[model samples]
Target: MDLYARFDLPPPPPPTVFSRDHTDGRARMPNFASVDEVSKFVDASRLWRHSRGANDFLRFGTAYLLVISLLVAAGILHKIYKRSFWVFRIVPRGHSNILIPNVHNSWALFITPYLWILAASSIAHIIGDARNEPVVNISLWISIMWSPTLFAVWYQAWGLIAARLGDGSASFEELPGHSLTKSMPSWLINAVFLLLPVVPSVAASLVGAIGNAHLEHARYGWYDWHTKYDGTPELTRDMVLDAQNIFHESIRGAYHVCISQAIWGMMCFLFGTAHSFATSSLIFSIGDHLQAKRRAVLAQKPRIIPQALPTHAPVIDRSLPQISQSDFSFKWRTADEAISKPLPSITCDSMSTDNQHSRIETRMYTFGQRMHDQHISFFPAIKSSSTIVRIEASKAERVLNFFIIQSVSIMLGTVALISDSLYMALHSYAAAEANNYESAFITGYIAVVIITLLAGTGSFISSTHTTFEASFTALLYARRFDPGSSDISSSGGERTDFLNME
Candidate 1:
């Protein structure tokens, strides 16, 4: 039942995987030995700081925001007209820009909305942190989380974009043991996410948005909403009290701005993490599909996999195959040796032709240098390495990586559910004894419920992602399009042989 047994490699490495510091280039800081070493380290540190100044960091940070917004705006335009699209070649790498593959709900397309949510939530965070308003001090901190969070996502995104559009193809997977993206976690950004629950009630922030968040239990909060009512209408009298009571008793005014925005930010972040993780998982994502095709090429044998709506090609009325639950369970049922050996990496490229017969192409690719066993992993560990078939994400791998990710989501969901239950139980007593508090309780409650849904949905999708992918992968490995087979469907001109990548 051990997933690692099926592979040619060992089990997933532990979270605290320790190996030699394989950082190349002697340009790094010197270890403390003598005063000279300390001086040398200090000098190197300053150089790094000077090279990547604050302004540069801010520019990169803001640039990413603008790029996401522009993508969303352009998608709206393309979706409406379908043909009135103009590809803005920021750094056009010959004809590759024109051949951008049309994947089924590419992350590049949907990612915009998630970023928008983060931006919206960030506004509330920034508002809460504005010292000029009430002098609420910064009391929160988030560990930049380079391996799996901000740094991982950023460099991978950059690499994928750079490789896909710039070079040719890009492949990636999560490796908690591997190193890279270790610039320093920006204290400025980290501190901004941490804001005082109220003036003078600020508590010091811990790692990763864990601070004294202004959740609904503040002693006092300023209410910011007002509506002129022609004397409290008789019918609306009790309802008004209940709504106000809901803010104080249910969520407290703190939940309205601070807590909800933070939750929104958390949920969006997980969504982004899921996108990056999907590259290695066998989910129903475009990247996964492309990966499936790549695996088929490396398949010592042919395979038959479930297919989704095609990309860029004409809409097909015919469904090629469907991955049943039994098929998915087969992978997790036990690591089947029949399962195809995944490549170290696969680079997928999308090319649109000028003629009507345009189709996504998978050109042959070869990895440069393969990391051998016993060698320490270091910066840019994403190089030609692979994880367990994420579609068939083994128990070994998810036991740590996926479990941790899902646990965070589950924990948030459980807490929110519990909070609501307690609020309901205490609402009447608190409302009866209430005097005055002007917090957006109803609005906050709505946001709270939405946040719960976000967490729940995110967890469900990730949990099922491996299942769906594993099942689809199982079906493909067992049966593929062969002209000799009776049950196999037509290939629809899709290539079966791919050399590493395109």
Candidate 2:
């Protein structure tokens, strides 16, 4: 039968009570008036009084197991710490002085206090359970679990800010789309970063609740006898056989519920991981595209000239000129005499030589003119708006904006995750108590530890990647916009003469 069907409500019943009279002097007591009477009698009887007894031993036992698991996980985190420590030391030596204040760093400031809270909560829960007392309750756990989701929302806002800063185009405001800057109002953006982690954390909490409910139903059936006793009791063959069918049905229902809860929790984990990876990948891809475009522009060579100029004069004007001294006394030779007396027979070969020399002189003169034109220096117009000082100032403003937003997000996320983990751990134990199933509590504890460790590791990796990418992008932009200072020459006269001759 379906689990929902099993939950069908039963018809109302009349009340009655059980009474034993010694007047009959019989060894056996008389039965109750009705089913209601029997149930009421059972409810009122001291036989089920042990149900109120606190299972302190079970609580402490599970708490200790969780602590040990955390210790083992801490060792894994330690290895990461050692590696990161070295990187932190080395990066500063080569890194630029401009440090983007990332919120991830703030985790260091509050991590100790956060860990203490978690440890204290766990211990309190264990001690309370050992003494049959309630430590942290469900309301507190729900609040804790939801914290991380809030942090994720906060981080998303930071990402938006970073996106706006890294945007290359100056007309971001005029672009034909909703601008990241304009569309996301300051309050709304901050709210989103504040609320992001809440979704996954809430999902996890819901799943955990379902798991607890399932365990509660299972323990009620399996340990129904023990609920009223300190230990397992032996039943007669007939009684045990009679209870087997109901027990099996309850167990099956509980198993189904627990499985569903597990699936739900797994979904939350997968979703969170996917979001983190997608965000990081997008940032990386955009940065790479920009860098590639810059490189392509820089690699192109300016157009080049192919050949050198030759040194020679043309002969077109070289022949002697006939002068008449203002058309008076000077005699000029006749055309026939000049032609016949062409000192050496002006042969085709000679003419060819004269043509070649003329071509050479023309080429040299043209080259010199080209060189002289190139030598004229025009000062590039100084537009204050396009100056390096203005550009750098703008970049600095953007960087500061991005850093402030991103850092807030990181800190919030870290706190939320840690708090949620602690809450879940305690909640799991509570669920186990409600069900009187030791295994359920143990399994839940293990799951919480595993999830916490995974989240911490994920955060650490994501922060590192974001940091590196941001640094690389900053370096790229710096090189592009600021291309360093150049030296100027002082010898002006010599330079001018060289230019005129060229």
Candidate 3:
């Protein structure tokens, strides 16, 4: 007590320099513990936030879906208009005798659908961006066009089923006339295919919702508009206290809206499908009408009548006196001479020519009979026999062909997905390093363009290959099933009339 009184000062206060426990009147800034932590927080608010990535993904995914859908739609339409119907016939090289128009329809098949898809997708994209709509909203609109595209896919599947049931023939008699609803397998039509077209839209919507949720959860403090001016006089404590009451009110609200987006997508998809179904049915009816008309015309052609004429006749020679150097004409034999002269017996060369003509006529009739027997008079390239064994063999061949093409598609899809991911990563890294985000995005866009071009090229090649393969397979089937038919032989060598559309 005596020593404390002598010192006359309290024990030295504890140092406030590195201690947060001090109760000092001086203001202290908030501590982040380390520079790295501050750097991480800043990055979260700017470059490394989950919301930013999610938004980018949404934009890219929507565009990609639109592009792919365009390609698929064009491909299906091309198959339906050109390959399935043979609306245009191939002409022989250097032989312009055919009266048919020479206009090429291939570009129409490619460009028309491209323009349609482009217009629809661009409109959706612009509207979504202008309105600041959610990803699911934009996707739902884009899916409207997707449903009609699937119609062609379903139509192709129907064609396949028709071919199988018809024993690899697509003739109106063998294929159903009512609609695709009748032609598709009951299980596939009622259950699988109908659901498949909706799956992509549903999956995308779900993914977008999940991504949005993740983005909201990982948001940083600095990103909050309230905390943005925390140190300034304009942000008062009382106001911040009041804002906390309503800040969390709408956090869960955005996610709940996804349900509505999903419903809208479903409705649009159904509408498009119904529209396509009706349109396709009408087209099928028209096709049936045209085929029936063609049959009637063929049946109405006049039959050629053969007359038995003497193969050889005595040569007529009448020498006339020359009236003038420039005006001299030969005289016909007199009626008496003509009546008196007996027709010479048919010579061996003339007889041989007659026999050859008879053989040709007999061969034509026999070929027609064989075509009827093969059940492919209407569909020339499709060859089917009365025996079930032959049909089964053809089915196996068709399966093999489809399997190979499907495998190629699967492989290409996988490669494209991986490539897209890798390119996106590259874009992100390059953009961050250069700190020129706009340029980076533009480069990414260029990459997408490249990818789309490559995809289009691949699709074109695959389609060409498939068309050729189908035609060739049909031809081979025809030859194997009807080897004796001279019609197929002559046309097969001279032209591509035997299309294996099956």
Worst 10 residues of 2 by lDDT: 85-94
Per lDDT, the best of the predicted structures is: 3
Whole-model alpha-carbon lDDT for candidate 1? 0.29
RMSD to the native, candidate 1?
Answer: 27.2
Q: For residues 1-502, write the lDDT of model 1, one tens digit per residue.
A: 2212322222221211111222331112112233343222222211112212432433443345555456555654654364322211122122211112211122233334444443343333344434212112111211111112222223223323323322112222233311332232334322322221121122111222332233221211222111222233332323232233323322222222233234334433553454344333322233343334334333312233334434655554543223332222112212211222222211121101110011122211211212123111211111222223323223323433443454456446545634543442233122212221112222233334355346635543544453432333222222122221222126322222211121
For model 2, give the RMSD to the true fold: 25.5
TM-score of each: 0.24, 0.34, 0.31
Which RMSD values do the candidates have, in order?
Answer: 27.2, 25.5, 20.8
TM-score of 3: 0.31
- Candidate 3 backbone clash number: 1
Tens digit of per-residue lDDT, candidate 2, span 386-435: 11111222233343334333433444444444444444343433332222
lDDT for each candidate structure: 0.29, 0.32, 0.33
Superposed by TM-score, candidate 3 places the C-alpha of residue 467 at a distance from the truth, in angstroms, of 9.5
Give me the candidate number with maximum TM-score. Answer: 2
Candidate 3, residue 451: lDDT: 42
